[model samples]
Target: MRHVYGWLLLTPAAILLIAFTHFPTLATVYESLFSKGSTIRPSRFTGFSNYESMMEDPVFWKVLTNNFWFAVGTIPLSVGLAIAMALLVNRTLPGRSLLRLAYFTPTILPMIAVANIWLFFYSPDIGLIDQILGSFGIAGHNWLGDPDTVLPAIILMTVWKEAGFFMIFYLAALQHFPEELEEAATLEGASRWYYFRRVVFPLLMPTTLFVLINAVLNSFKLVDHLFVLTKGGPNNASNLLLYYIYENAFSYFDTNYAATLTVVLLVILAVLALAQFFFLDRRIHYR
Candidate 1:
């Protein structure tokens, strides 16, 4: 009777997982093996044809490279800033609450709205950055218009937007940490930096792992701001894989190719998850 009741309780969630996650993944894989249909032409099986085309597509390669750089640029910087912000705000300094709020406010705002605000900040000569540089006799340069600067500009905004949210996780970990360790370290005349490096950091490894995984996933998944900010402009300089998938599926009406892109994304995420479990989990110290 208990087993029966347990199965009954699990049924709805299992159904939902299968319906939404498993089914869609399988469907995407199925679709990626075929050719796209049109008004006059019908869909047909062309095994691995889409994948071959994806390999041949220069735009796909560009977007994939962009995503790699995007992840590389955003993850470490955002996570480091998050740790710094958490440490700063964790202390009972003057107006600490206000400082915390200020740090966290960007996380709560919609990315579209934030992107719009940043658009002005990146505008050529009229932007806030240019205006500030003008006072120092520094000539203003186009921030987003140039391919060299566009990806970096997007990365900077992403770090600013994501850092605070990661900070909350770090702060929670810090709060739950045992204060006795700090006291002992203080009695031993250990410097703050030494104590943090030796004692505090090891204990926070689990939280760091969690935040790192989240940052990696966000680096790939979060493309809402890109729509408003650049639309992958300046000759696809700022394009991301997810945004490219959107372009193919909706804008170009190429669902099969989009499915192929999605399959690649799924494989990347799966490999990342497996790596975290196998490699990263071993290094994390859990209490």
Candidate 2:
């Protein structure tokens, strides 16, 4: 009777997951093997033709390369900043609550709104950055207009937005740390940095891994700010894989190609998940 009730409770969630997530993913894979259809022509199976075309597409390669650099640039810096912020806010200090709120405020705001605000900050001549530079006698340069600077500009905004959210996770991990460990370290005359490096960091490994995975997923999935800020502009300098998929599907009306791109993304994510399971699972220290 208990097993029957358990299966009944699980049925709705299982059905929803299959309908919404599994079905769409399988459909995308199926569609990627075909060619786009029109009124005169219907989609026909081409058997890896779309994948071949994707390999030949220069824009696809450019965007894929950009995504790699984007992940590399943002992940470590944001995670590092998060750790720093978490450490600072975890300590007892004056106006600690206010400081915590200030750090986390960016995380709550919509990315579109935040991107719009950053647009002004990156504007060439009349922007806030330029205005500040004018006072220092340094000539203002175009921040977003230049191909070289646009990716970095977007990366900076992403780090600012992401770090605080990661900080919250780190803070939660810090709170659960046993006070007796700190007391023992103090009795051993260990320096704060030494104690943190040798004792605290190992205990926080699980939270770090969790945050790292979230950061990696966010790198691929969150491209809303790109739409508002750069639109992958300055000759595809900041173009990311997900944004490229959007361009193909909506702007160009090439659903087959978009499906192909999505399949590639899915494969990449699957590989990452496998790696995390095989490698990181062994290292995580659970309480």
Candidate 3:
């Protein structure tokens, strides 16, 4: 009777998951195996043709590489900044509430709003960045138009927006830490850096693991900023994998190819998630 009741309670959530997540994922997989249908022709089973095409597609490779670099650039910097900010505001400092609020303001803003705000910052000649440079006798350059700078500019904006969010988790974890640990460290005459490195850091490992996973997921999933700022423009220089998938699905009206890209994306995410769990699960010291 207890088991039946438990399942009855779980049924709603299970149904929602299957309907929204599982069904769409399976449908995408099925679609990837077929060809894009039109009035002149119909979708036919093409087996691995789409996959073959994806392998040969230069734009696909370019975007995948961009995604890889984007993840690498954002994840560590954001996580490190989050930890640092959490440590800073966790102290008994003046106007701490205001500081925390300021740090978190970017996180609460809608992504579109954030993008729009940065759009102004990245604008050529008359923009904030260019204006600062202009005052220094430096010529203004198009930050978003240049292929070399576009991805890095987007990465900087992403780190600014994400650090605050990750900081919240770290701050929460810090608050729950036992005061006794700090007392003991003080008694032992351990330096602040040493105490943090040896004691506090190990204790924060679990939080770090969680934050790392989330940061990685966010890096790949974010596209709203790209939509507002670059549109994957200037010769697709700043394009990431998910945006490329969007371009194929909607802009080019190639849903089958989009499905293929989606499947690949799903596989990459799953593998990375599993790898993180497998490796970090061992080191995490759960309280």
lDDT values, one for every candidate? 0.92, 0.91, 0.92
Residue range 101-123, candidate 3, lDDT tens digits: 99999999988899999999999
Q: In model 3, where do residues sit more than 4 Å from their true spots? A: 1-11, 276-287
**Per-residue lDDT of model 2, residues 1-287, tens digit only:** 99999999999999999999999999999999999999999989999999999999999999999999899999999999999999999989999999999999999999999999999998987999998998999899899889899988999999999999999989988998888989999999999999989988888787888888879989999899888878998799999999999999999999999999999999989977986786575433344
- Give the alpha carbon lDDT tens digit for every residue of 1-287 in model 1: 99999999999999999999999999999999999999898999999999999999999999999999999999999999899999999988999999999999999999999999999999989999999999899999999989999999999999999999999989988998788988999999999999989998888788888888878888889999889988998899999999999999999999999999999999999987996786565533354
Q: What is the lDDT of residue 235 in candidate 3?
A: 91
* Candidate 1: regions farther than 4 A off: 1-4, 279-287
Residue clash pairs of candidate 2: none
Worst 10 residues of 3 by lDDT: 278-287
Instruction: Rate residue 233 of model 1 by lDDT.
Output: 81
The TM-score between candidate 1 and the true structure equals 0.93
Candidate 1 global lDDT: 0.92
Root-mean-square deviation (CA) per prediction: 2.3, 2.2, 2.2
